[model samples]
Target: MSKRDYYEVLGVERGAEERTIKKAYKKLAMKYHPDRTQGDKGMEEKFKEAQEAHEILTDSRKRAAYDQYGHAGVDPNRGGGHGQGADFGDIFGDVFGDIFGGGRGRQSRARQGSDLRYNLEMSLEEAVRGKDVEIRVPTLVECDICHGSGAKKGSSPTTCPTCKGNGQVQMRQGFFAVQQTCPTCSGKGKIISDPCTPCRGQGRVEKTKTLSVKVPAGVDTGDRIRLTGEGEAGESGAPAGDLYVQVNIREHEIFARDGNNLYCEVPLGFATAALGGEIEVPTLDGKVKLKISQETQTGKMFRLRGKGVKSVRSGSIGDLMCKVVIETPVNLSTKQREMLEEFDASLGGGKHRPKEQGFFDGVKKFFDDLTK
Candidate 1:
């Protein structure tokens, strides 16, 4: 007969959480444990069924394979047994008193630690030019005392009597038995008689670790720097996690950045706009000469090549674009006002201002056409 769906056998939905999956398996296993039934063949089959279901669903890797390919993905007969056989003792040792066999299985192995994120604030200058910074992060590290064993010196943990070191228990339901984590050793199989003073039986301690992070040049807001093996320590001496440094660049005083480009607005004197001349303009490297042409108007843009930022991902440099705004004379002296009035009188008053001359010409034509 084909095997039952693992989720259906455990009485859990496909999206059930880790804790929920464990609870459902525990309830079904208790209802079908062989020890609870006396010489009943039906109960024995149910108990075995629950055990098989628990074996596949509890493990993350096995569960993923089962989800994608069903029983064929995990069945040993189908040549999918790259993983060793799942031990009932490992699953139900804590609860069932090691009915299968009490011992630490190879299923529990050292794994990498979790990853962490730290938001780092930077000035626009630092982001453009790059900088090095130090950060302090609080995380769990392997305990120095007892060498992460959670035991007193010269004394090691012993196998849990209740689980017989199997760390799981068997629950018998109405017609089935299922295996689950034994509550005795909490699935560790070994019992710590004397807990470590530092970590308090966890084999790890919470401490702040100082780390130096190098921010690369041209990195902008929302960019990230990944620090490998800098996250929280894993359980049972597993591998560590990675730490991510998130970049948040502060607003600049005079410039706005868009990708690799830089933008700035510059104010020009009226005389300078009327007559072309060279003036010094500010750039990241230093000041550069920018020429304003005669009759230059407000909102005129000038592009300075290779003055903008280079992208972190792509090394392409960009241009710095400057928008010019003409400033009219303000708070003119009495003599200056009189001189301006004399100059205005000398204009011949009609066609000297080309813009004004064109406007009147168009106005005269409009009225003449309307009259016709």
Candidate 2:
């Protein structure tokens, strides 16, 4: 029987690009793979046909010949045909590597070191003004004794006999050829006959390293600063990872921060709040005198512009918000109590306390309406 047109087998257009052809083949291969089909003869044949079609269509020279002369130009059984058996290893490597962890020879894979995170605590003033901090981190570093070779000073690593330096071994499972990391070499592709004393045959050693990190101004909690190449050391001379310094601002006794804004509660004496006066308020910089308006109520907010923090990224300054709480006189002496009684008798008509009068009036009206 004559073979089906490669494009027809893969369900692609005659002029489809290589990528389109590969995509179609991947779909069909996944659907009809022997493992999924469970030994169905028809599905097995269809899978083979898709693989063969993909193999020919992806090769530029083979595709051009097939496009000009159809199957007759590329059929392996035909005289002067250019087609050869499809390489299962290459096919599965492209499609199933991520799924099965099998693919291209991983011989001498250079793994990148793992990134590390360090929590750095800072005071509000330190975060606002910025400071240089020293941190000690326990991480992996390249072995100096063997120079990261994992071998003794006088000896060197040799190729593994099991994988023959390929770093991978091939296993045949039914119709599929799988490539896996070599068990003996553990994917390093080499063996250390004489191990290093310091690192114990590993190319990296654990050590504590002290580094100086420059903290930028106006950095809030949860902000991060990156220090490159300060993390764990990579294996087999690979590139080292990075260290991220995570900022954690400690709570201040007098102030709370939200983004760039600073909030604080200011206590005012009842006499000062009612009579109006200038009071000293604390700020990150220094003490600032704030004017308290006459008859100022509790919970009144006073805003001090540009007294908060400037954003590190935007460079825009914020304001400090102070909420005042009126404090009443406590532990009155006999004279103070007598003066307070006389003061109460002097204001018997509730003329100075408009809020208190309005509240009592509302309460009386509610009771009168209920009685009616």
Candidate 3:
């Protein structure tokens, strides 16, 4: 027979939080506990079912896989086992430990610090050539005085006397054996009577730190550089999280970048466009000479091989594309204007202005078709 959904078995929503799932499972465990049932096989099976649901729902990786693939994801026989098989003693320790703040699994389940992101803006020149940058970040760091232990120098934490360091106390409520966090210790299992002065027993302190980050070449906007263990200090001295330096390239006045290629518009004189000549175009490296053919049209694109940005992924160089826009002469002298008018009249047969002639011809045909 097929199994029931874990969420349904626990009487909780699929998106229920860990604490809520734990609470629901605790209630079921209390109701169907074998100690209370006294050899009733039916209650034992129900108790096992609740244990299974609690185990799957509480684990992040197992929960994620179960959420996507159902029971097949966590089933060890089917090979989608992201779950570490639940143990009876360990599960009870967690049930009472985490739910009641017992801190029984503190050694094995120390939480990591939160990841952080810092946005860094760069110039095109700086991006093309990788550089090291200095940045200051405000975050939590392990207390220098306490060394993340929350205890005073030359002092150590002592085990709690209330629950005998089990972090929890078992109470007999009629037939039910109820487990709860030790009130005196607040579930820490240990106590730091003389706390660190700097961090005040928190084990971490807020401060600003300076760090140097090396940016790789050819990284575009939205690329990130990750520095491992550079984020805020972890709780109870666990491993720190990573810091992501997000890249945002400042807009360049001359060039636009596209996937290892650099693009720019070069202004061409009208005479230079009409007659073949060598002209200088700007590139990332420097200016390079480009030979323009006669009758070069505006918006003409020219590719300069191996003149663009180097690929960050492939270690290959790209090309630079120059687009030519013909610039009409302004503030012309009387003689220059006269010469241009004379030159314009000489091409009256319309052989030199193919685009202008074709536009007028198309307009004429459109009007004729409309009249018909």
Give the alpha carbon lDDT tens digit for every residue of 189-218 in model 1.
Answer: 777887776666666666768999999999
Worst 10 residues of 3 by lDDT: 91-100
Worst 10 residues of 1 by lDDT: 92-101
C-alpha TM-scores of all predictions: 0.63, 0.68, 0.66
| Model 2 vs truth, CA RMSD | 21.3
Error of 3 at 111 (Å): 1.5
Q: All candidates: CA RMSD in angstroms?
A: 18.0, 21.3, 16.6
Which pairs clash (backbone N, Cα, C closer than 3 Å) in model 3? none
State the lDDT of candidate 3 residue by residue for 1-372, as single tens digits: 346779899999755889999999999999999999998999999999999989999999988766544454565553222222222112211111122122234432235665555668899999989899999765567888888777889997788788878778899999999988778666657767887777666677767679999999988887989899887577567777677787878889999999989999999999899997999988877888999999999999999999999988898998999999999999999999999999999999767999999999999999999999
- When sorted by TM-score, best at the front, the candidate numbers are 2, 3, 1
Residue 100 lDDT (model 1): 17
lDDT, model 1: 0.73
Reference-based lDDT, residue 199, model 1 = 64
**Residue-by-residue lDDT tens digits, candidate 2, 130-216:** 999999876678889988777889999999999998889999999999999899877779888887877767777767689999999
Cα lDDT for residue 151, candidate 1: 77
The CA lDDT of each predicted structure is: 0.73, 0.78, 0.76
TM match of model 2 to true structure: 0.68
